[model samples]
Target: MWKYIKWGFRITVLIIVAAFLHYTLPQRDIVRITGTYNRLTEVGANSIFYASPDSGTTTNTVDRRDIRFIEAVYPDGGPMVYRNEDTGWIWPPYFKYDSSNLQAEATNAISPKDKPEWVAVTHYGWRLPIFSIYPNAVKIKAVAGPDVRLIPWVNIVVLVLLGLLVLMLWRMWAQFKERMIEPAMDDLNNTLDAVDARADAARDRARGFWGRLFGRK
Candidate 1:
């Protein structure tokens, strides 16, 4: 049924929006730094995410570039890898251009497995092994411990602003329909009624006009 299709579309849209926010919004992970290094990476032309192509760091090659990487491990001994790249002046608005500084901070935070020094890595992105994509780290700093609690203030504020923006747009659309669309529709109906009252020929002409205007059956 049309109703089922409409609901399915709505659910699909909601899921996409949720996934987008999850990937774009910054998240903090408490991990112990293990190593810092750079490797030559081949970038696909179809990549949805864009990096700054660091001025001096990246060399001219066909779909290939040098990428900085920071390796770390979680409290549970699980491995975590992050990519260091400039976001430039666009998209995500992190405006991060200090990959070197962050790398240095991460290097300072590195501690051995016996005396693990917990550091919170702030980043945004999904690590898809199939695509060889890693989360881009924006900030790195020492934390009290792996159990330290971190609040997502940025997400809360951003969500609130987005809700207000949607509400404002909905109100504007309602006003437009009430003030313009409804009045025009009423005039159309009145004209059609007048045509119907005049004669059969005129009624046929009006029906033809109506069908042409709205494609109504």
Candidate 2:
């Protein structure tokens, strides 16, 4: 029926909107964070410390001195944090000098003003503190790490596929209504109308006789 077809189209549109939000919003940061700790008897001055507040209960802490800081923050908020205690390094959580224009959130718990203390000393990873704090240090002049960008051409491809799917569903639904449901409903409606007409006529023809029988009219 036309009613069913209209309902299906509405449902399809709702699904498309949901899918778009799922694919494009709240995107994850793609920059990778890494560093090297001392292989032998460790010196305290060489290790690095990093942290990420949004990483939930589980966070990453590494001992790499060259960890990318601005790359993680700018453009996308960030995935990781970097710190170098030995170098007296303190960087801004929002001040990204990288290609991505990520800055510290205005409402973030960790801000530039609340400079977090460094935890890991190069000499011993075992002495790391248990406090949750944002890193105040960053690697400067850092380029953006590789990210999977949304290409217009790829979008075109996706749109084409979505169009084809819509067209296919439309054709199939039209055929189903035409072949299976519409003719049956039409027949039922016509039969009901005829029955109604016959009942009206019968009532009209017998009404005067009944009235006169009841009251000498």
Candidate 3:
């Protein structure tokens, strides 16, 4: 019974461990797809980098606010996206497109081709990311970056843990068999030996009584 109880406990622990690993192992994969796009630039130097949304005041709703900073500037007038070194969030500048400045070839003026129906800045040498944002939302469009592969690592770790659990279960069963079953078998053997000794004594007594009564010698 004690052996059974121990075996049950091991099985229960193993089951719990397996369940916990199964539930907690697979986490959401966060891939770092953006990085230092450009250095920090002055607020009004090239174009206005918009951090605040055009609509919907965040004051009463969530009370969330975003802080703006300068990252970098270009020697020539170019559309550049700057990201904070500490935080990976990209903050692009917001600019009013002027057709007259475009025709006059002004330094800060943005062209319509570069401003693809969005709050876009036209910089000749600058490249825009594949991601886009709307006026109401302050979402930054992201292009390709480091491909953080998560599924493979997750699978390998989980498989290794599962293998360990199986090995532990095997070892636990062996221990239970040795401690519980082997001891019980030894006790059974001892009881059988006592019964055999009693039977032999009874037969000897009966034989001696009969010989004495008959007086054969």
Q: Is candidate 1 or candidate 2 better by lDDT?
A: 1
User: Residue by residue across 1-217, what tens digits does model 1's lDDT show?
Assistant: 9999999999999999999999999999999999998888888853556474543347568677787899999999999999988887767789887988988888887789998899999999988877788999999978899999999999999999999998999999999999999999999999998887788888789999998989854
Q: Show the lowest summed lDDT stretch of 10 residues, model 3.
A: 116-125
Segments of candidate 3 deviating more than 4 angstroms? 1-155, 215-217
Flag regions of model 1 displaced more than 4 Å.
54-57, 199-217
Each candidate's number of clashing pairs is 0, 12, 12
lDDT of 2 by residue, 1-217 (tens): 9999999999999998766533332223233333222111222343223322222112233322222222123234334443322222232122323212222321122323133211111111121334422233322222233344423453467668888998999999999999889998999999999999999989987896798788874
TM-score of each: 0.84, 0.38, 0.27
lDDT of 2: 0.39
**CA lDDT of every candidate:** 0.87, 0.39, 0.39
Q: What is the C-alpha lDDT profile of model 3 across 28-90, one tens digit per residue?
A: 222221112222222332222233333211222232333221122222333344322111132
C-alpha lDDT of candidate 1 relative to the true structure: 0.87
> Which structure among the candidates has the greatest TM-score?
1
Better of 2 and 3 by TM-score: 2
Taking all chains together, the TM-score of candidate 3 against the true structure is 0.27
